[model samples]
Target: MFLERYHSIQDNKVLISARQGSLFAKEVAGDFNPIHNPDERRFCVPGDLLFALLVAHFGLSRKMTFHFRSLLGDSVPLTFREDDDGMIRVYDDRDKVYIEVEREGESTRDQSIIEHLIRSYVAESGKNFPHTLKPLMESQGVMFNPDRPMIMYQSMNLSLTTLDAPEPELELGQATLVPDGKRGNVTLDYRLMSRGKEAGLVSKKLVVSGLRDYDPNTMDAVVEQFYRLKEKAWD
Candidate 1:
């Protein structure tokens, strides 16, 4: 019953900017401060804010495939904890989220499990961190008849750094990323594929949008909005 699968931050590129606490937490504290903005009384949490920032920093992917320029340069170890229970487990001492790709032929579509685990992980995480699938679900919701998503078999480099590449004749959706990192040429497109049939259902260049802070208060509201779109975003 291989339905669908996903990959999070799987590289060793996560910058460890804090000891007792992560720098990400510190950033969240400032932005998600409840008292900071009286008009914007909502305020986010360190964990939730960190996740959103990762989405922004990493550049959203179509079926979970991130752009090359958005990740750590050269070689980075793709790592994450196994199973949904321990997947998004954000430890109080560590402000980080683990990422991983399932083993071959694995049924990655487990929305109930995903929702449950995320909910539990953030249950006591404060108003800022709403542990639910509302946000992600709003976009893609759930891949019910989840088909096999594209598997990136290989990625390479080319001459000319700063310059960009011509748009591919074939693609499922729009793909883009922050252009401030690398330089020289840009004739390369991070190619991708599906591990199963019906590969065209997904885009070769997936664009995963980062978490958005709202003018309205609370992460719960964001979660509710996520599920509405997640089911169709992939389509």
Candidate 2:
């Protein structure tokens, strides 16, 4: 229900306007990536928004994996399809796929449970930049290009031991970055906590391109600029 304003369905096709996507990125997920800015030339909907929409529409499965195939631009008319085997695909009218999902095991359509998980996951995800990735990059002696930071959501997997928790929260666990030359793969592991007990786990994979030798001074400026943008947006 919270996602209603972020997207629209007409003629069985979904359309997400740039403003809608931007609001969801900043207001909901707390992600201030420039690419999600409405006026940016490279504006695109946040991948986490799409992930949240899937769970909201199809319910939360015990095991689910989302593989992002392409960047979804604003106002794209997309369609969703689910196969008998529990594979879901989100694609544009051109038939170009943006995300593919595979789900298994039990599921729940409980709105409270879904909303809680969505909020908790995105809140933790919004901290990936300075909180998680910065230290990981520093330890690995690498950092994304300062001028043109290119970090993309590649895929994410979710596994739940049960679907009984109505207000489960996500806590960040171990995070790792594996670098291969100019490209780096980032994996963020998270735990689902219900009433102080572990309920399940989730992992998000990201691809960072144009990585170069880490420079503390350069990175510091980048981080500062990021916070500045966030402040300006809220102002």
Candidate 3:
């Protein structure tokens, strides 16, 4: 599987290196979040990578919800366990849960379907920063602190009407942001389509911290720096 190179399985435990996490964030998901930088002091593996790994391991169910508990660091040994009640947990040796998954209905292990959904969803997710979140923040007259902007994935829920699509694509639907003082919650809704037919719906939630009054010029500069980092990494 394509995900094998991004993570390693040893003795029933999964391990992800800093380099591997960084590569998957930048190269595969097109996510340029500074937290995913290998050399950064606050480096953390991208939550999307963990979500992908879960699907890769357990297969995609008709309905699934993923809740992120903690930030995963590089080289952490993780154990994935599924209970009889359809709850899947990914924890470390210390038994600190990093992610919790709830799955229901039928599932499929078809590689083509899984790969297509993973790529499309992550690609759409990678555009969350300037593409989706920017306008949503602007609408609320709020923006993340330019110097120390922080956006954390909270949870994602997926409900599929059918999983028969061989190659489904994810499309952005309605997105909303609700602010409370200095913090804000963002909900991104997406539509899953295959051959022009609706197959599923997905909702992803994120928490933005240190929000301030929206300043277009500052936000633009911040976005520019983000692209510059991506370019530097690619070069």
Candidate 4:
């Protein structure tokens, strides 16, 4: 899996490097968040990377909720342990938990199904800044700082009434932005699609801080820069 390349499995613990996390964010998730930059002072691993890893290792669950408690730095070793009650925790050597996950219902080890879900969800999420956030911010009369944008992934939850199908996809649902001074909370509601029907719904939250008045020129440059980075990677 592409995820394994970003984190090393050693002694039953997964170790992530700055370079690996940065690449995964930009290349795989198409997320250009500055905090994920390898050279950033406060560089941190992408929650999407951790989410992909969890599904890759533990398989996809019908109903799952993931809560991120802390930011994980480069070269940090994480241990994922599953309890008897089906609770999962990603922690450090100090046992300080970074992520807590609770899964219920049936699970599937089908790699194809899992990979599709990961790709679709991340692609849908990567569209947040431009396709989703632009209109959202306009409605609220607030936007992110174009020069030094900061969007933090808080947590995500998904629930499915039943997982009786094999194919899984993601459909964008309602999105709302709540303003709190210079920071805004972005809640994206989406659904899991299977066999041309709604299989589950997912609610993902993000924190956008350091907001400012909308500037079309700067935001245009920012959007262009993101695609340029992704395109260069493909080259």
Instruction: TM-score each candidate.
Output: 0.18, 0.96, 0.96, 0.89
lDDT tens digits by residue: candidate 2, 1-235? 8999899988889899999999998988888888889998989899989999989999999999999999999899988889676689998878899999999899999998898899888878788888899999999999998978878999999999999875678888888999999999999999899889999999999999999999999999999988999999899
List per-prediction Cα lDDT, in the order shown: 0.25, 0.91, 0.91, 0.84
Tens digits of lDDT, candidate 4, 50-105: 88889888988888998888889998888988977768989899998888898888
lDDT of 1 at 112: 40
Better of 3 and 4 by TM-score: 3
Could you give the C-alpha RMSD of every candidate to the true structure, in order shown?
Answer: 19.5, 1.1, 1.2, 2.1
Instruction: Output the worst ten-in-a-row residue range by lDDT, candidate 3.
Output: 163-172
Per-residue lDDT of 1-235 in model 3, one digit per residue for the tens? 8998899888889999888999999988899988888888878999999999999889999999999999999889999899777699998998999999998899999877888889988888889988899989999999998877789999999999998875678889899999989999999899998889999899999999999999999989989999999899889
lDDT of candidate 4 at residue 198, scale 0 to 100: 86
Among residues 3 or more apart in sequence or in different chains, the pairs in candidate 2 whose N, CA or C atoms overlap within 3 Å are none
